[model samples]
Target chain A: MNAQADLNTTVPVELIDEFLKRIPYVSEGITNVRLLDGAQRVMFDLRPGFENQRDLVASRISEIADKLCLNYRPGSSRVLVKREALPGSYRQDPHAELQQRGDIIAFGRGRYGFGPKLVRLIEFFEQRSREMAASFQADPYNFPALIGADVLDTCRYLKNFPASLNLVSHLREDHSVLQEFSQSVRWDGEQLAYDRNGASGVECLLSPSVCFHWYRWLRDVELKEPRAITALGKCFRYESSNLTGLERLWDFTMREIVFVGPAEYVLASRDRLVDLSARFLDELGMAYEISTATDPFFVDSYAVQAAYQQGFELKFELLAPLPYSGKKLAVGSINYHQDFFGRSFAIQAAGAPAHTGCLGFGYERLALAFLAQHGLDQKQWPAALDAAITASAAHDKA
Target chain B: MTSSPNESIEQRIAGAVMRALKIADPGSSTPLRMGSTPGWDSMGHMMVVMELEKEFNTRFPPYLLPQLVDVEAIAKTLRKPA
Candidate 1:
C-alpha cells in the first residue's frame, strides 16, 4: 500500500541522509521510505495492513525528525581518503551468488551461516589485519562473546545506545523454576513461549564492540609504556528492521587494534591506522571513502551525542561502495576515546588517565563489499587479494 | 522570577549547574569542571545545558555543547552577542 507523510518542518539537506538511515528502524511496518519535496516530506511504502497505522508511523517520524534532524548543527564530514572504481569493475549481486552456491545460509533475520568460500574470505581479511597489527607489535588476544553487564554500564553504552543493547538471560537455577519452565515451554508458531517467572535476572550481554573488552581486561592497570592489542571477536547489536544481507547484521565478526597510552600516542596510533587502512584498501583496488563519522545514537540523545562526536572529529569510518545499490557500507572505523574509557576503568598511563583509540574492521562487510565490487570470479579479483586467497588455499591443502 | 540584577553570569551559571546536578549551592568560589566535578558526567552536562538555556532564555548551537566544559567557558559563550 502507498502511504506518505509530509514532515511539518524542513530537515536540513545535510541531515537528510542520516534521517533516511534511521527511518527503517522507526517502524517494522515501514518497508521503505523515500524523500519527497526535497527534504520536507517522506513517503513510506508500508507492509500490508500497516496502512491503518499510517498516522502513528507518521507521528513517530515527525518526532524523530524533531529530535534528530532539526536540533543539531551539521558538522563538516570531511572525506579523508577516496578511491575511484577499479578499471574493469562492474556492479553485480553477490548475495544471490553466495546463496545459490551455499556460501551463506540464512538462519533467521540478521543471522547467517557461512560456507567455506565466505569463511576463507573472512579469514584472509583477518590475517591481513593481524599483519597490520603485528607491525605495531600489538599483542593478540581472543575474548569471549559475552561481556558482563557491569562492564557495559561502565562504558556508558546504556546511556548512548540503549536501543541497540541485547541482554542475555537464562532460566533461574532453582529446580522448581527449571521444572516449571520445562513443563510450560512450547513453540507458539512465531516464538517460544514459557512462564516468565522462571527467567533469571540478566547479568551479561552479547558484546556490542570488541575493543571494550580490551579496556575491561586492562582495568586499573598502570602501563609503563604504550600498549597495543589486537583481537578478533563476535559483536552483536540489535539493528531492528535496519538489518539486511551482509551489510548490517545482529552478530558480526570484528577485528580491533586497540591502543592505550598518553593522548598523543593514542591519537598518533589512530592516524597511523587510518593511513595503513587506506593503503590496504588501495591495494585491493576497491572503491571506498574514509570520512569523519558519528555513531547511531538513540534518538533522544542523538543530537547531543552525534554533535559531540563530529564536533571533535572523534571517529572516522572506512566506507566501501555497494556497487549495485549506489550506496556505501562502513566496513571499518578509527576512533579516539581521549581518556573516556581510561577514566571509566581507572587505567593509568603517564601518571594520569590513559587515552585510548581503536581501529576496527567488520570482516563480513569487508568480504561482501569485496565480492560485490570484484565479482564472484576469482580472476576478476585484485591481484593482491587473489594471491592471498591462492596462498591460503595452498596452505590448507598442504 | 527574575534573577537578581546584581547577579554575575558566573553566579547564574553556577545556579544552573547546581540545579542540574541536584546539589546544594557549592558557593561562588568552587570551580566545577566537566570531568573533574562529581556528577558532571555526559548526561549531567546535557542537563546543565538544558538548564542554562532555560535560565538564560537562549539556545546553544550543537557544536558549542562540547566547548561548555567549565563555568568560565559557559559564561564566555553566554556573554557573546547572540
Candidate 2:
C-alpha cells in the first residue's frame, strides 16, 4: 500500500491530483496550487478570511495524513495554535440580560444602539478621549466618513483589504433604469440582482480606519517636521461569525491620534502614546493589560506580515475583560506603521519615507468593558464615570 | 503491523525527507535544516511529517515540525525502540 517506499522515483501525477481532490479542505480562498517536489511540497495559495484559515489547513493536513497513513502528533507544530472559538453568535447574545433591561439594543448583526445610561457612559469616555488628545496636543481633524474609491485604491486599502472593502454605489439617474434595475430587488423573496449597467459604478468605499484621512491629506506633500493629529470617526469592517457585541463589529467608532515623521520620532511617539494610554486607563481605574497584537484584517502573505508585526511588537492592544463571553477584549491599540503609510502616500520626512504610528481607542468597546466590569447598575459604576452620569442626569433635570 | 526490523527510524526519516526534497546524492552535504535546504520549506516540512508518521507509525505535532531540523532530529523524535 505504501507507494514508492524509497521515494527515489517520482509518483504518478494522477494519484497526487487525486489526493488533492480528496483532501477535506475549504477551497474558497485558494488561488494557486503546486504539487511538484513531492507530496510534502503541496502548497495552495489561500487568501485570508475572517476565520483562522490555518485551522482548516491543519485539519486537511491531518485528513491527508490519515489517508496516507501519516501520523499527526500534537505539541510538535507552530506555537500559534488555534483556541476554542468563543461561545455565542448574532443569534445568541451572551448578554441577553443587558438587552432585556434595555441597557443595550442589538439593531442587527454588526449594529447596536445604547439606551440613555449607556449613552451617558459613552459620553464619559468621550471626555477621557478629549483629555487624552489635549494632553498629546493632537491637531484635531475630521474627514469625510466615506472615502472615494479611487482614493482608497491609491492608498492600497483595496490591495490590503479587498475582502473587507465596502464600496458605496448609487442607482442610475433615469427612473426607467431604476425600474429596470428593480428586477434585482426582491420584494417578496431575497434577491441581490441589481443592474449596474445603467447605475453608476462604485464611487466610494466606507472608511475602514481613521488614519486614511491623514495619509490622503499628505499625498505628494513633503513634511519638514513631524505632524500629529487626533481624529474620531466611524469605521467599517466586514466580520463573519466573529462579529459579536462590541468585541467585533461591522461598524464602530474609533478615536485615534496618528504621527508621521522620522522613524525615531515615530517610535518615540508610539512609546509615548503607549505610556499615555496606560495612564489614561489607570485614571479611569479600569483593569487592562497592554499586550502585543496584530490587525486581523490581513491573510495569506499578509498574515505573515501580521505575524512579523506581532514578532516585532509594533502593534500593542489594551485588553480589558468584558461582561459578555467573559473574555478579555482589545479596547484600544497602538500601532507603528514603519513607513507603510509614507511609502504608499509618497510622504517624505527628512528626505526619507516617513515612519508613522498611531494610538486608537474604541469608545463603544470601552463602554462595553465598563459594563462588563462595573455591571448595569449606574450607582455601582466607577467613580469618575458615575460622577459624569450623575452630573449629566442633574443637568437634564435642570 | 510494524515496520521491518531492518527499516530503521533514521532510514525512514531520511527516505521521507529525501523523497520530499528529491536529493539524488544521499551522502551530499546540503543541511536538512529548515530554510536551509530546498526541500525543507514549510510545505515540504508538512509532507515530510506526514510521510514520517506513516513510515515510523509515530505522530508529530504541528509545532514540532519547525524543530525537526534534519534527519537526526526526526530520528530522535521518532525514537524507535533500540
TM-score of chain B of each: 0.88, 0.71
| Model 2 regions lying over 4 Å from their true place | A1-94, A181-198, A323-326, B1-82
Q: Write the per-residue lDDT of candidate 1 for residues A175-274, one digit (tens) a residue.
A: 9998888888899986899988888899999999999998999898999999999999999999877788888899999999999999999988888998
- Candidate 1 chain A vs. true chain A: TM-score? 0.93
For each candidate, what is the lDDT?
Answer: 0.85, 0.66
Worst 10 residues of 2 chain A by lDDT: A72-81
lDDT of 1 at A9: 77
Candidate 1 Cα misplacement greater than 4 A, ranges:
A1-6, A20-57, A180-184, B1-82
Against the true structure, whose TM-score is highest? 1
Worst 10 residues of 1 chain A by lDDT: A84-93
- Which of the CAPRI classes, incorrect, acceptable, medium or high, describes model 2? incorrect
How many clashes does each candidate structure show, in the order listed? 0, 14
